[model samples]
Target chain A: DVKVTQSSRYLVKRTGEKVFLECVQDMDHENMFWYRQDPGLGLRLIYFSYDVKMKEKGDIPEGYSVSREKKERFSLILESASTNQTSMYLCASSLSYGNTIYFGEGSWLTVV
Target chain B: AQSVTQLDSHVSVSEGTPVLLRCNYSSSYSPSLFWYVQHPNKGLQLLLKYTSAATLVKGINGFEAEFKKSETSFHLTKPSAHMSDAAEYFCVVSTTGGGNKLTFGTGTQLKVEL
Candidate 1:
């Protein structure tokens, strides 16, 4: 079974704080992604990396960045957190471009 | 440009009743469609996928979907609804040449009644 593990299941941060959300996939998938899920808006892509050190901005990449340092690990960064950035962050990885993907349990971040 | 649309934001059904969640899509090329379910406070789970192989796709939890290229739709259905079926469902599309990118629908909240 493929497993995507998120480092933090819940987090609370004050406005203007830098937040980091880490994700590790045991499957060693090549493609990784960061998505922010909000009510009514659904899951919007934030960024995706096809390989280590390579990233592409997705539909909703503003105020967010991502890093893929290893084959099995991807990280999402919130440079400066704000109340609007409070939402559930999901990390996903796929075997290849457009192939079936797996999602982490999700990191719920709350900005005060 | 490719996009996915989930027709209803919310659908209510009773247990043992039929379930239908409609989704429509527009893509520049032959698309890969998927239906994902998310329980409250949980991550998204892939319910089923249409990869152009079969028009009718059966998925986990006794759910299924049918792809209609003519209408550009991939609608999810279940013969019976269970209380456990209550969740937020999303429709996603991956265009042939769109790389690994997936366009997601706004989402539909399925409420199963007793």
Candidate 2:
């Protein structure tokens, strides 16, 4: 079974704080993604990386950045957290550009 | 750009009854479709996928979906509904462009009544 793990399951941060959410996939998938889920909006993609050091913006990438320094690790960075940024963050990885995706349990971030 | 529309924002059904969730999509290419379920406070789980191989696709939890090109719809159905089946179901579509990026619907919340 493929397992994707996020560093934090629950986090709380204050406004204007820099927040980092880390994800690691055991399957060594080549494609990784970051998405923030909100009520009524569903899951909106934030950023995705097809390979190490390569990143692409998703539909809702504003105020968010991502890093893929290694194959197994992907990081989502919040430049400066805001109250509106509070939401459930999900990380997913796929073996290829278009394939079955395995998702991490998700990190719930709260910005105060 | 490709997009998906889940016709219902919420569907309520009794246990042991059939479950139906409607989804429609528009894509420039043949397109791949998927149904994902998310329990409260849990991650999304892929219930099934349609890769153009067959029009009728069977998925986990006794659920299935049919792809109708004429209607441009992929609706998810199940023979029986259980209490555990209550969750948010999302209809996803993948187009050929943009490196197979996926587009998700607004999502339908399924409520199973006793």
Candidate 3:
């Protein structure tokens, strides 16, 4: 089975602290995505990478940035974590356009 | 552009009764629709998908959804509700020619009463 592994399951950080969430997929898919899920707001895309060195901004890319140094790994970086950034973050990967996508278990982060 | 809307915030049904979860979507062109289920603290799983082939799509765990173009809806249903079926279901929309960006709805929480 294809697997998408998230590095952190839970994390607590102080306000203004830099945070990083890492994801790795074994399927070798070209598309990788980062989304933050919140109550009533649902899952909002933060960023996505379509190639090894390419990245694109999604609808809710306000304070988030992404790095796709390699094809199998994608990382989400929060320059300065804030209280409002506390939410469940999800990582996903897909083969191509409109194909079935797979997700990681998700990382819950809390900024105080 | 494409977007999705899950009609209910929550739905409750008896264990042996039928289950229904409503969804609606809009797009500039023909869109690929999907239903995903997320259990507590787990990753989202694909329940079913509609890629313009069949109007009715069947998924795992006895879940099925029908695509109605006239109503612009893809509603999920199950013949019998099981306690393990309790989870949050999301309606999603994507396009074949539009870079495959996924747009998800707020989700509907299904509660099974035994």
RMSD (CA, Å), candidate 3 to true, equals 0.9
Q: Is candidate 1 or candidate 2 better by DockQ?
A: 1
Poorest lDDT segment (10 consecutive residues) of candidate 2 chain A: A94-103
How big is the positional error of residue B74 in model 1, measured in Å on the Cα after superposition?
A: 0.2
What lDDT does the true structure give each of the candidates? Answer: 0.92, 0.93, 0.94
Task: Spell out the clash pairs found in candidate 1.
Answer: none
What lDDT is reached at residue A64 by model 2? Answer: 93
What tens-digit string does per-residue lDDT give for candidate 2 at B77-103?
999999999999999998778565788
Candidate 3 clashes: the total is 0
After superposition, the stretches of candidate 2 with alpha carbons farther than 4 Å from their true spots are none
Itemize residue pairs with steric clashes in candidate 2.
Answer: none
Off by over 4 Å in 3: none
Model 1 chain A scores worst on lDDT over the 10 consecutive residues at A96-105
Name the TM-score of candidate 2: 0.98
DockQ of each: 0.72, 0.70, 0.84
| Per-model TM-score (chain A alone) | 0.97, 0.98, 0.98
